[model samples]
Target: LHNTSDYRVLLMDEDHDRMYVGTQDYIVSLDLHNINREPLIIHWPVSQQRRDDCVLSGKDQNGECANFICLIQPWNRTHLYVCGTGAYHPICSYVNRGRKAEDYIFHLEPGKVESGKGKCSYDPKLNSVSSLINRELYAGVYIDFMGTDAAIFRTMGPQTAMRTDQYNSRWLNDPEFIHAQLIPDSSERNDDKLYFFFREKASDSGSSAVYSRIGRICLNDDGGHCCLVNKWSTFLKARLICSVPGPDGIETHFDELHVKNPVIYAVFSSSGSVFKGSAVCVYSMTDIRTVFNGPFAHKEGPNYQWMPFTGKIPYPRPGTCPGGTFTPSMRSTKDYPDEVINFMRNHPTMYNSVYPVHKRPLVVRTNVNYEFTTITVDQVDAADGRYEVLFLGTDRGTVQKVIVLPKDEMEREELILEEVEVFKVSQQLYVGSTLGITQVTLHRCDVYGEACADCCLARDPYCAWDGKACSRYSASSKRRSRRQDVRHGNPIRQCRGYNSNANRKTMETEQYGVEGSSTFLECQPKSPQATIKWVLQREGSDRKKEIKSDERILRTDQGLLLRSLQLADGGIYQCTATENNFKHALVRVHLRVLNNETVNLVLTHSGLPMASLQGVGSPGTSRAPNPQYKDLLQLLSQPEMGVINQYCEGYWQRPANIEKQNLNKQQKDKPVREQRKPRNRRNHHTSWPQLPLLANHCQ
Candidate 1:
């Protein structure tokens, strides 16, 4: 159930009801339904000789002399191809599930070792990504011991391993790999292509800067002969820009991207400074495809400068996958002449870069110091439309749940739904010391409410709008007729008939605090585009008064904060939000204030005599009440209540209560000449007796 080592690589086998996990020097298989049960763990440590050699090479024994499992890919239904950093020397092996003995829980398939230098990393901290495509391993990694030879390679094939030119900055210049996936060719005429997303140093920008890129390589490519032997023949990369046009007319770009599907979300900081904050930008797959099909960049002679190639192209094109009459044997780069192979070798990068859809990010978070490490997307169905929920994991052991509202107007903005601290700590956690998020997975759609509208509106492929309730969908369900029209259908109309009540929900709450203390009231709108308004409703008055910010009442983030509470502040406060479409959401709070005299009178209702309560905490008495009761007595004796921090704005502490003895002494020491007669003392005492025991009682 628990592993001390970082567990990042995981594969779920729904057919076997098991989950496979890769960690430091070990691979574990656990039951998906009951992970508490003992898991089958395999110890795959590096050889003792290798560990010894790592330490001899001036590396720490505790850090570098251990195998950290990096990549785990399912080769087939019965086998897994796994690779690891083998004590600073990379190596890999295949794991078989069919070899388990009858009595043993696990037995690995015996296999020969293969060099994993380009499949994993020498340093565990470095980034490397690999995926199985067309029965071959497509990987982005550092190919040398010094990690200076970064390349995208297609390894483990019949002919020979092919990679980007070694030490070639034009191909990949100081890159940090994020992830890779094989997108099935929509045309179906061409072979599938593997796309890798990464952040690398940009050269053509005329300045030292990092840019996020999406690189693609054909699966049918074979090493070129004579011209660029043992190198990729159809590898190309393009820049991905996800930036916003700032108010100052400057474009802010997010340079680190995480790709999933139709959209690729990127995290960007204003600068290299850690405290500059970060933003999440989104780019569409359509935009990426468009950029790839645009102009191609070529290296000219002089300084070998990169410029758009305008010459006539060869048949089947330079980077096209082998297709139609062109079989692998006929169209492979090895079969091409030296002239064709040399041209492609010098032009691995595309001339045009991909820009984000609408040139803006779906979500932008500001004033956050922690950089995002990983991200996952979820969807929720609402009356308006499907909301794409983004869960971004940060370096500070926290996960931020955000949502991109479907454009209700001319503009759309990202909403910060919640910020969750995944790890608990009593003190501040330091950078690099915090546990990095290895993965984020959304389990299932069972969490959606049991309404057809709820499931259908979510627009999650895993869920469908079953007539009665929101539930998981099956491929050949006889109830397909019961499902509402989704594809090419309006979501709001499908759910509007049955779920109108939730769309019109209004929130009402009551807030109670002591007079002369602070109080906070909040109203949170689901959409960030909605403008907030606050109004006060006084007793016996129907006239509405708009609340204004002053020294006594200040507006804080998403709410209102009232400092130094007074009797006049007690009223029915209402908060209303108006969206661009004129749809309104409202929340009302009835706040009541209680003075010290009224609080003391309420305590007497608990059956304690007024005189006994007053003397309960007298000094130097053996029969004195408990110290806890003394604190309570002091609290009740205070002139006013402390301020309440509503809507989680910030913290507020109350001033200590004045001692009763000091108050009595000051009253006795007052000069008779200067003393004034107590005005309506009897009337004030009589009013306290009639005060309500609870603030809500008056409401």
Candidate 2:
């Protein structure tokens, strides 16, 4: 059985965990829970030689009859409807759901071609059977004496038999089964319209890949008696892709499909292989939704924004394929998608965050995509319904922790303010980003800093954390975050702030105009003080608030003299205050430096133009070494958008009449590291859709 060819089928009595399986050479009953794959075999009374002697007109003579089902789905606590895929596929025995070995019911009477021989028994079963919600069984299999093409068969349990005043339909005098699927309606249920899916092909046998056509064989309310000459006609034939996305973002594939639950989450791969970076997509209630943070590669602009509606846009729209907006890099102008540019210029929604599945995943071309190495959501604590902490899996296989506070905790900008907080959190989303899985939990979501423990899961299910052991908390009872009475290990204690250069205990600001220019207004702290405190821990709408004259509002080397100051002092000012020996103090101050706004411009043609050193003549042509650049540099050069970055040591835009040395360098260049791309690659080719399945009777 291990080396050559020995197959078997096992039917587990859902109630008692008893199982029965039939293979090419044998049939058996098993204790599935105590699995050793090697099942206990039950020998048949007939021998191999005698099998050939019997022939049924319903099927081919020499072929094995055991090709269908040998296991049974219990119709009740006591009975099972069983059969095999063999020529003599019969309602052989009904076993007690509790103990199969002791309760053998009855086998059907077999029919044969030549009077002396019995029915052919090749495989234990000749068809596949699935159960309905209430213990009734539906099978699609071939009947030897009937035909090579299979039909449908329906059998019910004791309760259903008495309730419907019936147990099974018939084929002539014998009850019949239809080999069709019972399709669930998308809407409006009608007991009269039961549908089924099937598989058929042009070839007869020996197939490498079976291209099957799924069809719906529908039955009317009065279809009860059509069993004798049962024939399933085609309905809607289709093929499901092999792979899909798991809840955790990994690509998962399907090896088989069953009637009980029919949904798929898989990816379309590059080489028809799995795990080659095949991002999984989920299909539920019909429409396909790709999981994970990626959109269509071609659709992302130089900025790589995720636009969920790219596919909905006109094909080859100004920003799409053939559209001028498809720049390989955000800095490149090569065939820049003017359509998308124009669309973006005209519609504000173009910049809104509407993530498309495969097309432009970015809703805007400016916000940098969040680089996730590993992002997991777990109930690291159970005290409350808080899943704020996110475990990020980096490419180096290093684990980074990040905590994302709910809207109730901070403003929406606070969420975006995180550069490294994307690193730490308490809840765990157990999936590696590099692992290439697509897991999305849809629980709840909002923009406010409110607690999202109870209500947030609906928006993003993955964010739901059951913290039975990690933290002491509870989910919000309603759609709102539950306000917790101050308790131990609360959010306040969970969130901590840190900055490395502890020795630099000072506050600084920007000055106005040239040196020795007009002074400005701002405050700065000096000397050693461990921490700079913010006057208001939570900032809100109004600017001013009531304050008492007593508390040490500001402390500094100059001793907190918050009055007139120099122009260079217009920036972030800090004051030192220590709490429990921790040099931590609350800070509250604002600074403004005056400066004339200026604009900078960087002209980009295919290449640099050649002309006089000072533009004395027409510029000659040469490919610009660096045409792709960030817009910030151009803004810094142009005097229009705003004044130059005050912190930088360089001037704003260069004067047009400047000398060679001043005009010959990149205006703004910063040192930033490079990132890695997905190692696994997959492509799901979805046309606006014209598939071969349309060739069937679907028309």
Candidate 3:
């Protein structure tokens, strides 16, 4: 962990309360509860000869010419099979730990290192996926030194080591593996299959196009006897389509895949840079099985397009497991006929593509700056029902927390907590980056607020209002007392008797402004989804009227802006927020407008220099004073001006050159202000006051 980079969470053993992490030149075992506890570290740097050879072959000395631990699979209860890019020469070894968690000892087993040619990738930059299934390693990796030959290999078991057809573009063309999952098709062990998710260059769609794919191989396959010896006979792949339908009869496809299983949650991104986007698609195991059982894709010749095979189907279909329920008599692929093996080799691609649930993506983000790189899902049993919570990682190093409502709507909330990659296990999240790993809780329910309405409107499945503060929700708790409505997020219906601030009076702040100057009333809502409205009642009028934007008055998210204040604008303005048909007043402002005569009298009585107030009433001056001075004169009342004058006298008594240097520094360091492009600048101006600057000299 000290001298390594590119840290990846490899395995989480909850029973032992340890999480295994693999990084460059090291394999680390961290305590699940407290990562700050000294981790069990193993230093496995590449040999000097391998590093020299890697550098001589034109790989980077610091980056590519180093041992990068990539795979750590549980071989048994006491051993783990670890693999790494040993400076471009892949190697594997067995790590020894004690049989029990209490007596665990972490060390590399001596003299057990072997070549990992087919089970690991030589280059650390290339993508590979592997799963240790029943002592057999099912891996999708590039098998050659130059990283050109990619294949799915089944090795290290009692059966003969079998792989996909080597150097065959029709089988796998430049595939970048994402994940490997072992899904049991039935109760029988032989019916279990290993599925690989990847994105590769499409052979049928020319060289530039890439497509997402889901490929599977039966666990019981033992290679064919004569036709395809030492090759997979039950290997079949199908296109995974995640696309958006367009009005022009064309579909925009997302081709890069990042997948997680048990209900496949796939995060995909568009390959093209011009249309940047990412989407989350959910695929069912039933849908994937149906596509593999459908017709196979066949090509007549080199010039012909791929079409569904209409020829006579062979018995015990090409993709069927050798010892499954369909063909229990055939114990292995070696028992299959030569004709069936030959047919399987020529047609490994399924004709029908697999579509996600709802025939569309669950979440889609287009024209965004960041692409989703990884994802994890949590299925929670809320007070109402069950809900799936998605934690999506973006390339810009932030996790987006999204929850799918019962009405097929998605509410996305972002946690800008860390700039690190996220991994979820059980109820906690482990985020890792070059700096280190940090553990985060799934929900910080106290952040919602102390009010029940706030907790109910948050719509978070993990949190609810328990007649007091917001806390974690449990299904076994008193459901009728806790308030949670994830489906509608209607706080009015959920927090009827629990809202404490429902009848509280709105606090009013007194604000003074000059007749020719400007002022702003500040009010911000607690919730982002709330709608804000401003209503004003005059000093004498009893009826209140809603304020609409005009040349003099403008509304903004922060508050209401009143420019060039007039006498008619003196009133009590209330800022109200409407959410779920519930109205609440956020703030109230009582405004008082002062005329030019009153402002001039206040400045004179304050004992300030007449030179600084020269342009207050006269209009024939060559150059006006700084506008900030006018703002200061408008803001200070008669009682406060005396103290302000004392501060100003001490501020101006400094040397002239010091003031000049300060002015120059301010002019040089001031940031360029951005202006709204659509609004007319002729009447609109800044309503908020700024720091006062005295440009006029006192003699």
Candidate 4:
């Protein structure tokens, strides 16, 4: 695990408590409960001849011409069908584990390797998706070595192999496959369909526009009789639109798709370089089906625009499977008329585009550096109701745990990682990257904090306040005793009896700042949703006034920054947070500004020679004090006089040659001075050198 690389694919078999990982030249099987334990590894490197041939064909020997395992699908109860870019040739073999979970025997089956032309991609960089249903492999992959022939193929089944129209841009044009799913349309087995989600170059558009697509084909479709033999007779694809409305009737499109099924959660990103953005859109199966059933797009002539076809529809619609509920009379697509087959070929794309459930994205992030790469959703049954928690992975090696509350409010917490390739099974998330694989728990309820307000303000559906501590919420637990408000997160209303320190006095810390120097009052709010405000009460005053930010006084998310500290800035500053109409004081700082004269007096009394303090109050002098004198002055300004005296005594006790060496190095590194015009004495005060306070150094 430490030395191996390219750990990009992960397949979990929860029933057997094993996770299979695919990497370069190896397929690894690890224990679900403990990954660090000895894992079963199978070496599946490419043959020397194949590697030589790949290199001869202009592929990198170390990178491209390698056995990079990219696919691992369950072939049966105890066997896995694995495929790899076999030195650019693309080969697959079956991996055999024991029949039962207790049997730990795992190995690659010998003499079963086969050519994977249609099952896997030739290039490891190209994306592909596949789903095994009824022992047949339905894949969205490139069929050629050059990767120009992108197609959705059905192979490794009893029936004749079927695929999309070869070399037809209308079917697939530079497609980048995202995901594949086998969804049952009815109780009948033959009615089941295989759906492929991808993004491809738009065929109808003249420009280089890409569009996300949802393409589906009937599972039972064999071939056509006369027009399209050995090709799919029920292939239909629809545009998947995930966009946000902009000004002047313009819409911003998110064309790149990373999709998951079953209440489909698709992460889409804008392809435009100027406005980088990502969005999460949720789609229902009903809406996808409706779009597929709508009118088909057609072109009237060579240069005609794409529009809805008004021609008479063929019997047993072009996308319908044989012997399904709608068309029980036909037993095979070969029995359909030539008109139906030709129409299906000419109009594989639908007219209407499929929109998300709410016609908008659940989460939108614009002008961000990273794009969403993968997503997985887990529905949790909390005390109130069920909430869908989305774990969205980003290209920047992070995962965002997001939840949408009632009234369309959303909250998110980010989990950092080295890299991200996420696969979730049960309560564990298996993340794969080039470094290695990592297993993480679904919920860490204890990290929210101990206070009731802290727990409630988190608004995480997986955690709640159980009177004593913040812990994982269970539906069976007594709801009346627990405190959780994910919808509104009104901590004041929900934590009335839990906040015992509501009336406790706020603690104030003494902070010193030098006059004409800058210092920050640090105060971080516990909750990101809370609004921070600062108030100042002058010394010996009874009234407190709200502090407004100006050029010198800036309020940041962390705290308030007081620049060029003045005597008026010396006051008790209080940091407050307001959330859900509930206000609480977070921190208080009693700032005391030290003038230049006080600093000079402190330095003079610290046993420093008068020569070191000669230019302390003067400005624009060519003969300045040594730089080490400034370090001594900074140390002497601290209240810990005993430590300062100890350090000074030790400094002077160093060898005299070492002190001379230090002085020589300082003078050697100093920059040469340039002549400048003299300033009028009346226009500027003598710029005294200010020593930074110990508190500022700590901050």
Candidate 5:
């Protein structure tokens, strides 16, 4: 599938060496093997060589690509539908559009065949049609008569004679339908009947109800039949979801109903007041009274009984309404109500109109609650009574994927949230509110044929295909071999190290200057061409201070930026990236920017001043000074790099060669005493304990 050019969504068919992609404009199929390991990419509909073909077709001038596509074998042959961003029109093509029905081009591309024309074509009439099957594109149209509900249409087949069917009915004349699901049993070709499902709310307040409806038309139904009476019929009617409360509010938007496996999954976007974000619910296909309740299964009394919808839909319960305020509106009868007058007041959407329905159809029928900000689309796959996989693609181009784990009795899929990402499909994921396509093509390099074991083994880790094998070097063997690193450098890579000054104790702070004086925000290892932007948020204020000068700020290679000082530039300066979206380290710098000078630092008296005195008067000493503070004096001689407190935790580190006895004596004395006598005067050594040492030293 081909989508918007940025990131394409691709489906790889390993068996056929094929890849299908959905795009922002048109879908493209390519043979995975033909492009080597490298891919020959184009904008859209535009192949590498024929880049202007789509422009020549007179549709997309700038060649905007399709944003999404869902490829399936819905018919006798493979069909591909391309949906794009802002393109009201959606297009379709068969992989074999240019080939004979028998000639199979598994991955639809133009070059597989010796020579062929491009098969893709555009269709303008398809409405808010998200899903398509074969050439028949089913859509939910919105018009004046019908509020948003659902509808299915024959997008491409030759127009048949007019008939009294839902497509042409006046009473059911609704294009506002949001979804139209073609029932599997709707092959009515033999009986000349077509069946599909959609929910209808005549007016915003016309008792907003859920109608599991099916439309049918006899092949012989003559043309120009009576106005609205000849068209559609409601097979099943009941109330839809209510009381949905999510983050924003209660959501009542019923998105789409999917029938796959043995279950029916229906999802509503943001269905709960509290949990009301976006919710997907599952209904058992076995408990399907409307479908399996017919006489064919009467002997078994509905052999497949669907479990009541108990997951989460958010429909209102009967007791939810205020005591006497409860009122349900009249539904469609033999004669449909006048849409221009009665139905217009009951539009079902939040913005357009309001429809209120009061009923406790089922428990799974109420707001199980999900969360969504402004999501309008959701999809869930179900099997049996369980939901298998969930795919919720938001209009913001976010695709939230959750997997369902399998259990013994529980066949439904469970939500595995750990696996989630806002990924970029080969192109954009959404055209507007749909999924874009991407392609993953597979290639095989004849490893055994090339048969170069030497070349393959040397390129350990990245194996060169050896005949029937890959020779990869083991880490243990490589370590033992200890060969010189002759590897080339990678253009893009990141390195990390601990933020420490010297002995692992370091504190970082910024320096400030006066109001008129210039300040320099400094970072280590400055680069000549590196640029920097300094953002300052005021100390107490929430607002950010703007930069007026471009000349002073500097960028450095050591992850620091220098800024020429100004009064307003004093708060917190955080360096931001200009070329990329990177918010570098944040630092709070207090730029005084004042008129008067302030004392910088009195390293001598600021905290605890260290004074080291050498024996200047005499070189010889007969007695030892004392035993206390012997090592402490030595430590005080080193330069101070940070705040110092003698009693601070883990502050003392004695000389590595000092004996434990000497260390204990220095620590326990009332005050530390140090031996200041000359090293050679041991013959007349005198020792004074702790406190008296200081007093005797003065004599």
Candidate 6:
């Protein structure tokens, strides 16, 4: 249950329903269904002499000498390839699952230690990332013990092992590797490409500053033949930006970020030096691709000014996969001319900076002190709808679930559904070192629900709407007997015209307020996409004037606002919305305005002096009500404040001369009109044929 500070490496095997955990001096495999079950443990501690040497060298044995498995990956169908910071010496090995005995669950392939320096981090605190493709392992790690010689290396291939230009600040300036993946060409017309996401120091503007970057390399990039021998010829990186919208037209950048492809979700604080709070910004794949396709940066001859290269480019553009005229059989990076490789070495970083797809972040939590270390996505089926739930793991052993909903054309709604406590530890060791999540796996939908609606709505790639229900067809017998294609199954087809419930159109509500008190008349639309309109039906008149926000009226996202109440304000207010330009929704409010004589008595009982309540205005004021009112008047305006003197004052003071009208049947078929600008009329008297004149009496 507790890995403490060493939850840095994890690998999940879905076929076996098992998750491998790599920690200090051990690698354990736990049951995916129940983590509480007995785990298969393998002791991978360092040798005694190595531990002694680590301690003698003034390093803590518990911290540095332990064999912490930094990388645990599947080699093939029957074996797992593993590597660790072998007591600062670094080692690699393979675990043969076929050779396992009844007593021992694991057996290592016997061989002398191979170089793991490039495969793992020397200091467990330093970051490292690796990916396996075509029997080759591509890694980003520090090559020296000083933690300065960083490089991107490709090994375990028939061609000579290659790496980035070493000790070159232009290529990699103090990079902290985060993630690596091999992306195959979707059209299968180009060579496979490898990508790396990290944050590194930049020297673009003659100054050093940290910036997030996305770098890419080709699979067939065997070291350059001429000037750049044994080094990558196609390495290139671009800057990434996820900043808060500034108030004074300034751009407040958040350089620290974490990327999960399709959507690169980043956590940015107030600044890099301070952790005032954190914001989660989401960038789409299109934004990242746009920056990659932008013009590359080039250095001028004399002034050394970095500018976008606009001259005629050479054959086989830098950082591009072999394709078209540039095929693998035709020529690899190894055969590239010296002029091409030399240009790439000088201009590894791009000129154009990448920005987030949305103007704002999907989720921006300002007060959270804990930094986010990783993110994993899951498609969840709920009663309301399908949600792309973000399972964000923090360095403080807390995981948060986030959902992004669309609000408007340029805005999004970020909902933090819940926060789960993963560990019971009272104290944490480091700021961002303890309880780091290495992997997160969401189970298949066959275990979710039996109802087809819930299952299909989940939209999980692992699930299919199998006519009868949403089921995991991949594991079902129907997959083999009927030859069902789970990947191509259409879940959305089963959910057409699936309206859970219809919206209520007509609503009745009541409000009470003092003559000079300000109040809010709420009439929010059920759907966020709907537009709201307010109409005022004046007392003792058959006219209903369309209301708009001006000096005395204010419009808000929630509802409409009336600056201050008066005798003329007493009327029936109609709030309506038209969604999809057809369906209508509305609510009616009967506002009751009290005179000074009635409010004065009500405030006397609420424990306020008569002089303090003078701001309620005179009994008969010719001018309009004041923009501000006293606290007592504001309190008496609220309907809930009626309890203060319910028995003595009869709560709401109603005009004894007014008469009520029964129009429930007429209000049922209320017609919705198209939205338009409210007409400017001095006499506040207008009639609509579609709207019937209902009684303006208040209860």
> How many pairs of residues collide in model 4?
0
**What clash pairs does model 3 have?**
none
Give lDDT for model 1.
0.64
Q: What is the TM-score of candidate 6?
A: 0.61
TM-score to native of every candidate shown: 0.70, 0.31, 0.83, 0.87, 0.35, 0.61
lDDT of 4: 0.79
**Lowest summed lDDT window (length 10), candidate 6:** 673-682
Q: Report the C-alpha lDDT of model 5 over 69-154, residue by residue, as the tens digit.
A: 33222333343434333221323344442233334434444533211101112322223433344444433333111223233333
How close to the true structure is residue 461 of candidate 2, measured as C-alpha lDDT? 21
User: lDDT per model, in order?
Assistant: 0.64, 0.30, 0.78, 0.79, 0.31, 0.64
- Separately for all candidates shown, the number of backbone clashes (residues 3 or more apart, or on different chains) is 3, 167, 0, 0, 97, 0
lDDT of 2 by residue, 498-590 (tens): 122222333343212211112222333221212334332122334433322242233433333322222333444344444223342223344
Superior by lDDT: candidate 2 or candidate 3:
3
lDDT, model 6, position 535: 88
The list of candidate 6 runs beyond 4 A from truth reads 1-5, 98-104, 204-208, 301-305, 323-329, 381-386, 424-699
| lDDT at position 419, candidate 3 | 32
Kindly indicate the candidate among 1 and 4 with the higher TM-score.
Answer: 4
lDDT tens string, model 1, 1-699? Answer: 233366677777666666677777888776666554677888888888999999999887876678888888878767788888998999998877543322334546676678896788888778789988656788888877777888887777565788888878878889999888777556554567888888888876466788888888877777677767778887878988777687999776767665655567666555554425566667777877777777788767787677788987665566667652344446565777666677677767788888766677666766756777667676644333455777777777777766555555446645554465655521111111123222223324455445544455344444566666655655456764334433322345555555554335557766665544455677665434456889999877898899989966887556788755566778898887653323333678787755546645654443334553432212222232322232232233333433111201121122224334534554576465124421101001111222212211211
Clashing pairs in 6: none
- What does the lDDT read for residue 33 in candidate 5? 47
